[model samples]
Target: MKNIKIKYATTFTIVVLMFANVSAQNKSELLLQSKISGVIKKMALEEKIAMLHGNALFSSGGVKRLNIPELTSDDGPLGVREEIKRFDWNSANWTTDSATFLPNGSAIAATWNPEMANKYGVVLGQEANARKKIVMLSPAFNICRMPLCGRTYEYYSEDPFLNAQLAVQSVKGIQSQHVAACIKHFAANNQEIDRGEINALIDQRALREIYLPAFKAAVQKGSAYTIMSAYNKVNGYWCSENDFLLNQVLKKEWGFKGIVMSDWGGTHHTAEAANNGLDIEMGSSGPYDQWYFAKPLLEAVKAGKVSEKMIDDKVRRILWVMYHTSMSTGHPAGSIATEAHGKAAYDIASESIVLLKNEGNLLPLKTDKIKSIAVIGDNAIRTFASGGYGAGVKARYEVTALAGIKARFGKTADIRFAQGYKANYKASNSDEQNAGYDKPDRVLIADAVALAKTADVAILCIGSNREYESEGHDRKSLELPFGEQALVNAVTAVNTNTIIVIMAGAPYDLNEIKKSCHAIVWSWFNGSEAGNALADMLAGDINPSGRLPFTFPATLHDSPAFALNTYPGKERTTEYKEGILVGYRWYDTKKIDPLYCFGYGLSYTRFTYSGISTDRKTYKTGDKIDVMFKVKNDGKIQGKETVQLYVSKVKSSVSRPEKELKAFKKVLIAPTKTATIRISINVNDLAYFSEKQNKWIVEPGDYKILAASSSKDIRQVAEIKVMR
Candidate 1:
């Protein structure tokens, strides 16, 4: 009896401590809120209004008398950009500002590992802190609706789940350093053509299922502190002042407590914007005081055109974010261009190189037998670290493919180089400026052929550069630009032991290459360590594991948007007629064959999938569906494999896609060893947004669960029933 009494007393003490901790945290939060309220109350109308607009190019006004420093932001989704002048677009040219250039968004997504995304965020946050930036304007994850979209390299996959998974981790990782991550181009800002004026006509179901998941997850789950409104219009409203999007869905439904800033002159109106949802106006033209949220807002408030309470709310949110960021205690002093940062860049780039075709097993080049290597192409030597329309980093150093190859194999083999093509592109040039740049240069091609004929092996690097695939304009076609097809044919006809390395962000015309080339590799505009990572992969130091984030259609016409003739829309309005059937969904449902399906990739080592099952044959709503499978390394060397799980409804009253990706895991295994893998999916995740009900509805029915290597490479399947 005495022992039992002692045990009860201990339990009571533990409970008391838990409650005390909660109370203390609550008190701290209340104190912060009280302080914020006091600051807001003390500010005059003009002072509060001043805080709502930009005072310079990359900063907004703050209360100097109250010790509130100006909130500064830097462009990202690559790395911290170089410092620019206060009042102009010219570079500040500070030698100390050079930073680490991380891999682009598509490269990270190709890794198919959310851990890499987290690492990327960590690097970004640290660098931002080092620059004393309040907000890191990054993680621009717009959906890749069309392959021709110039910003496809900057966005994630076509799948909402994949985008959501990466976005949540990226946000958490950035915020982990107490630096605010600003998620950008909110809602249907897919294409670059007419971005500021184009109206994206999207239905509610498609918006919920396809376009907005990543931003939603970033806000609700990752707790992002700032959002950048897109330059486009959704339906009939500009995103900067869209009431349904900002006020209703984001603020009320998702409970986002962050400030919404304009995307550099993306603001349209003064009164409408202030009343609708905009909190900060940035990058508008003319005098700072004349900006939409500057003097106009003050006048609107005094005339009762906009409420003073609304101004208080905006100030309160900004102050709240400030406390969490610049004013936060214990914020780490960030580092840039360090060896650790470079290694992080290398890790992502190494895994991002996808082996597309290896008909003769020509890769992992046997260095012992090779006497000379013919390295050809302009991309082999071109540095993509800086030249692009959107955000680009002033890299401390960028190792080109040629540099990496020479560093790796110069000791043993004689390496020769030839510029097979010229990247005749400049950001200032118009689309039609270099009209004949795509035509083959006879002299360059002949020189490349002559070099290839003499060497035992040839490494042909060919693809689009940053200028070809950029932010202001989409590509005219997926054809290998700069007459690369002719160059490839010429070089391949001489050297049968040639390895083709195509580097670009989005899918391109690979039909001819697939037919003629025995070996092919797909690379990206990867960052500073790109060449080093590529050399390691070719030398067999690291196995190729990156997967394709989106589907590669056989031709431009094979894609849904182009096939439906709905792209670039007629009269500045484009309707998403494809709806939820995007990427693999469109291909699978329509019985169309893609050149390469979503999540498709090849590795030197092989892995086989078997023994697929579920924990239960039946489950209720909110129950977890546990899926079990086994993957064995069937090759002689160890390799990493990304196991994908897709779910399909067997029978439904409404129309649905054939299947959808729910969860995935990347695992490494030793040669001849099998690893058992288990992935759990919430039954609620199986539901689709119903247009009729305007909410998600999980129907009671049997669903087919598929375990696969890729979207089209399903290996095992099982059935389970969901009860009401």
Candidate 2:
């Protein structure tokens, strides 16, 4: 009795301390709010209005009298963009502005590691600070709705769960450095075609399950300080002025405290945007004061079209963000393009190179035996640090594939290169923009074939570049552009020891290559150290561990959007006909096999799965399901494996996907060693958003937990019952 009483007393003391901490935090927040209110009251209507609009290309106005600094921003889904002229898109010509270019979004997602995402964010945030900027417009994580979405490289994965995981960590990582991470493209904004005008009509359930989770997680869990409204419309309403999305969903429902800024020239009306939830207007055209949120907003307030209270609220939010960023205490002095930042880029790029195929044990090239290496294809010499559309980094330096190879193999083997095909792509308004690009050059092919014939091994570097897989326009098809197919055929015919390395950001038609090529590697528009990372992987300095973030369809017609004829829709509007069944969900449920399934990647080593078990057979709401399994490395080298956990509901009353990803972990294991792994999932996460009830509902039923290497590679399964 005495012991039990002491335990109860101890629990009570801990609870009291927790409540006290919460109370103190609440007091601090209230104080901050009071201070913000004081500042807003002293500001004139014109000053308050100015705070809501751009004073420069990448910055908003601030009251100099009040000592408030303008909130500066930088374009950052890949890395901090080069400093541009204050009034135009021209470069500022600052030699010190070069930064370390981190891997793109899809490449980061390919690792399927949230920890890596956090590291990516830290690099971005630190660089933003180094540039003396407050906001980093980054970590764009729109769902990969289609393989040819143009910005697929800039986005994350097809799975909402994966996107949410990465988004949360990315946000936390960025904000940790006292720089705000502006998670972007607020709603759908999935396609680049007619992006500013097209309306996306999506059902509530689909929005909840497939589209909105990442943004929601970034706001509530990651505590992101800013969000950027997309250029497109969601359900007939422009995202910048959408009452339901910006006001109802983001601010009220999810309790987001950040400011909502518009995409470049994305604002439409002054009153509508101000009355809605938009806090800042950026990238709009015309005079700085004439922008929608500038002089127009002040006039709107004066005319009683938009309330003064709304303007004050917008200013308050802006100041709140400022206090957290530029005005924050003890902010770290950040460094840019440092050696450590370069290593971070290298680490992400190294883990991101996915090995698609390694037939005949041809990888981990026998460096000791090779005398000469023939590196072919334009990608070998191409620099991806800058070019194309959207955001491009002014990389301090970018190591090309050929450069990386020579650095790694110069002492061991003789290396030669031939530009197998011309990129031939230049962003323009002419007819040649997307035309006359794929035809292979016979002369270049002949040179490549001759080099391959004389070399002991040939590395054929081929695939899309920044210009081909850019942001302004989607690819017409998935075929290898720039006559790459013809180049591959010509080179491989002469050299049977050819290894194909695909340097691209999105999926392409690889059906032909999969059959013809004995080895294949998928590399992205990786950042500064792209070549170094690729060289290290090829030389077995580090094993390839990246998995496909989206399913690679066998054909364009096989994808859900194309199969249902709903993509790019009709009459300036598109319906999400595929609904919640996206990516692997669609393929798995429809029983269509993808060229490469989501979470699929190959390694030089092999792993075996066994001993799957759960802590309990029954779960209730709020319960955590603990899953345990064993993975044994069965190869001669060390490697990392991503363990994927998927859940399926048996005999559901409502329609559901075949299975949904619930949890995943990336584990590194030494050769011939066994490692026990445990992952836990919250029961609340299994709940589905019910449109009829307008709430999440967890149905009582039998759930099958599948442990797998990839979506289609289930290794073990355990059954559990959920009780209401």
Give all candidate RMSDs, comma-separated.
Answer: 4.9, 5.4
Tens digits of per-residue lDDT for model 1, 212-231: 88999999999999999999
Model 2, span 1-724: residue lDDT tens: 9999999999999977866777777867878999999998899998888888888889998999999989999899888899999988899999999999889899999989999899999999999999998999998998999888989989999999999999999999999999999998898989998898989999999999999999999999999999999988888899999999999999999999879999989999989988888999888355888888888887888889999888888988999999999989999899899999999999999999999999998898989999999999999999887777868999999999999999999899999999999999875545455577778899999999999999999999999888877788888788999999999889889988899999888899999899999999998999999999999998999899999999999999889889989888899999998889889999999999999999999999999999999999999999999999999999999999999999999998889999999999999999999999999999999999999999999999999999999999999999999998
Clashing pairs in 1: none
State every prediction's TM-score relative to the real structure: 0.96, 0.97
| Segments of candidate 2 deviating more than 4 angstroms | 1-22
lDDT score, residue 156, model 1? Answer: 88
For every model in order, what is the number of clashing pairs?
0, 1
Lowest summed-lDDT stretch of 10 residues in model 2?
426-435
lDDT of model number 2? 0.92
Against the unseen true structure, what C-alpha lDDT does each candidate score?
0.92, 0.92
